[model samples]
Target: MEPIQLTTAVMTIVNASRIIVQFMQNQRLKNQARRRQQHGDEDMNTDFSKATVSSNLEIMVLLGQAHAVERRFWARETSTEWWDHIVLQVWDDSQWLRNFRMRKGTFMELYDLLSPALKHKNTKMRAALTDHKRVAIALWKLGIPDSYRSVGNQFGVGKSTVGVAVMQVANVIIELLLSKVVTLGNVQVILDGFAAMGFPNCGGAIDGTHIPILGPDHQGSQYINRKGYFSVVLQTLVDHKGHFTNINVG
Candidate 1:
């Protein structure tokens, strides 16, 4: 044989492998950050169901845009498939299948809110049984008014149950949204807004209104404004610049 140069070639290959590994690590971190930005939310917590987590992650990845179509829903990979293939393979062995319907954060909130009422042994209705489905159905109906009866039918409950569920979820959502999105003003901000309109002393303005309802039970008071029928008088307060301050919804 003429010559063999295995050692030199091996060293060069090892150095190249190290550089390649570092590049891949950097690329992966950058990809994770880009993914976070694309979704507009942080990554999931550790305790979340693996199947649900994987399903959500795959869905988000495949369909991240406004008009993204879900291939998993079309039949390739589903929650059930993910549960069978990946979730069960993990050692923790959580009930990822049943937990698939609920996002972990929402599930946690509903569980905390309804655990007391649901824990009662005497409770019989479906709503009192499972807070996960109840909360989901409630949220779905709030945005889709027409689907109330349909969703109720699916759950073998009345439309009123759906309404109640939705109202509960809506109340929680409203409270959270108000706290986070609504910017509260101190006495200074209020005074500044009023001062802009040259009405510093005026705390607010009062306007009288009436809402017509079924015929009056008393059938005597004629002070009920307009509509030529039974109505309740309502007084609303507005700020100097016409911002609504308060309303006595009688």
Candidate 2:
């Protein structure tokens, strides 16, 4: 054979061998990628199954707790019988006055005046208290220096309920009667009465007292009075009849 032809044949054989080797390497890489994808899919499915099971268990536990709470009943110790049987039926007028600081008739009158503002309607959840009862509760709380819990036991109501009643009645009284009840009322007569008592040109008697209070958020130290207790000053002017003519509180 000629030397040029022999060299050309050798070059063609080498080129063919390179192509075959490159094809085999590409096929091997594809197989490896396929195996990796199958393993990843299996791991993802297992993780999803575990998460679903865990979520289901949490939901079941929550449902069981809800059912248990619904079935449970919590009863409280109350003395409604005392209020209904003794206070209303057995207590006399003097007893009423002693406890409430007002005669039964006066209490009724006050209730009649405040009923429109203090009344609450009965609902399916509970029956509303009578207007007279509400007034009595307020009067008892204001007349005595007792804790809300103590007052609640006496009235056969919850402590929180007693607190609510007192606040409601007090607010209503301030809104409806403060202006009419606490007034100078015949200024000339007041001056004349004070003059007869040897106080010249005095329309009323002025006095100040410290009302005990919880420490306030703003300037709490300022509320500490000389007596070493937190309090606000209440200044008042009263006429000869001892009716409040003017008042100031801080």
Candidate 3:
């Protein structure tokens, strides 16, 4: 983990040293050449040239050192794709689900089902990312509302990229997954199971839940419920199995 940091520090030092030595050597050679080329205003031109060369060499060396240091850090980070480490065996399945909000197999199955539609196109600039990676990015974003940067850090992507992934994946889920996963057939199964438990004719139970919100501008007071905090109402139909058979947002 720290080996990269140590290597980068060494690279910075080496680059600075090289820049200094090369600058000094170049100035020495230029001075020698200038001496050889000196045929007019010997002392005056020599002093002026020496001063100009010295200042320019110092400036160049500073700029080179800055650039090399920047390059070293950038190079160190670019080589690693941390998202792979999370998806692969570098991290355990438990950790993956804890962060991603779904089992690995479930995520993969979803990715496969949606890949044809969700998979990005390979443009002239770069190849498209895999469907699994895109889904992971979306899951992370959904799992925490204020976690764009955190998700980006874990997935080795930018916050804007994470946001885009979430939007695309969410559109796919709303279009294809929602109806497929929750339908009349699934609702009937839940009702039958609840009936078997002696809760007859009860299709689903209704419950009102208050979900606290920061409230939208211009009409925040309207959203303030009896609980004191500004929140929207969530009327949910939950089955005996503790699954949300249906939900109505207010």
Candidate 4:
């Protein structure tokens, strides 16, 4: 063989080996890039799964809160057995007069007169209270020395309901009956009766008393009377029949 040919053959072999090395390096770089892209896709999928789970948990929590509120909306339950079972069925006429400060007949007559004004119809929430029950509640509150809460317990109603009923009954009575019942009828007849009783020319008797009261927010000291108690003055005049003709309070 010639020396130049041998040298050319060695050069060719070296060129082929360099080409193979370059091809192997390119393949390795492409493999690494593909592995990195796969890892990125996996991470994106994991993040999306976590967000979906979080949203579902938030929806479940809101539903639970809504159910809890619904359960607590109307929790309190009061008994009506006192007025329905005991007072209506068990009590007698004497018991009625003692508790309400009037006979049953008078109470019914008053109910008949006032029912048109005080009547209420039943609604979706509850039954309306009877007119007689309302009248009894008001009379019991006025005649008995008890708190509104106590009166409500006996009447099978709320304390606020008792207070409202008392005010309503009182206002109605004043509007309907005050002028006719509290007036001095026939002035000469009243004077003659007073004269027969040896009180000449006197039509009525007048007196004043201290009514016990809670100390007011303003002028509290002024309400302290000579008896060392808080009170308001109630002055009244009465005819010969001992019926009230005039009244004043402060």
lDDT of 1 by residue, 1-250 (tens): 1133455445455555655565565556556666666776445322223434554554454333322322222212212233234443552424432433444455556557654443323333222425655665664554343566776765555667678877766676556544443333355667777788887765666888666555666754664555565677778766555655566656
Ranking by lDDT: 2, 4, 3, 1
Single out the weakest 10-residue window by summed lDDT for candidate 2.
66-75
Q: Give candidate 4 misplaced runs (Cα > 4 Å).
A: 1-75, 89-93
**Residue-level lDDT for 89 in candidate 2:** 82
Model 1 alpha-carbon drift over 4 Å, by segment: 1-188, 198-200, 216-224, 240-245
lDDT of 3 by residue, 1-250 (tens): 4787678678777767776776687677667657766755466556657766776777686666556543322311332267665356576678777877777777778888888788568865445666777888788776766677777777766677788898999999888877766544466777788899998777777889787677789888899898788888888776777766577788
Alpha carbon lDDT of each predicted model:
0.53, 0.78, 0.72, 0.78
User: TM-scores of the models, in the given order?
Assistant: 0.30, 0.64, 0.59, 0.64
Q: Tell me the tens digit of each residue's lDDT in model 4 across 27-142.
A: 56556555766777666455545654664565455445434422112424778788888877888889988888877778888888888889789866668878888888899987
Candidate 2: misplaced stretches above 4 Å?
1-77, 92-94
Off by over 4 Å in 3: 1-80, 186-191, 208-214, 225-231, 238-244
- Judged by whole-model lDDT over C-alpha atoms, candidate 3 comes out at 0.72
RMSD of each: 28.1, 24.0, 11.3, 25.6
> Which structure is stronger by lDDT: 1 or 3?
3
Question: Candidate 2, residues 97-148: lDDT per residue as tens digits?
Answer: 8988877778778888899998689866557877777877888888887888
**Displacement of the residue 170 alpha carbon in candidate 3, Å:** 0.8
Candidate 1 has what TM-score? 0.30
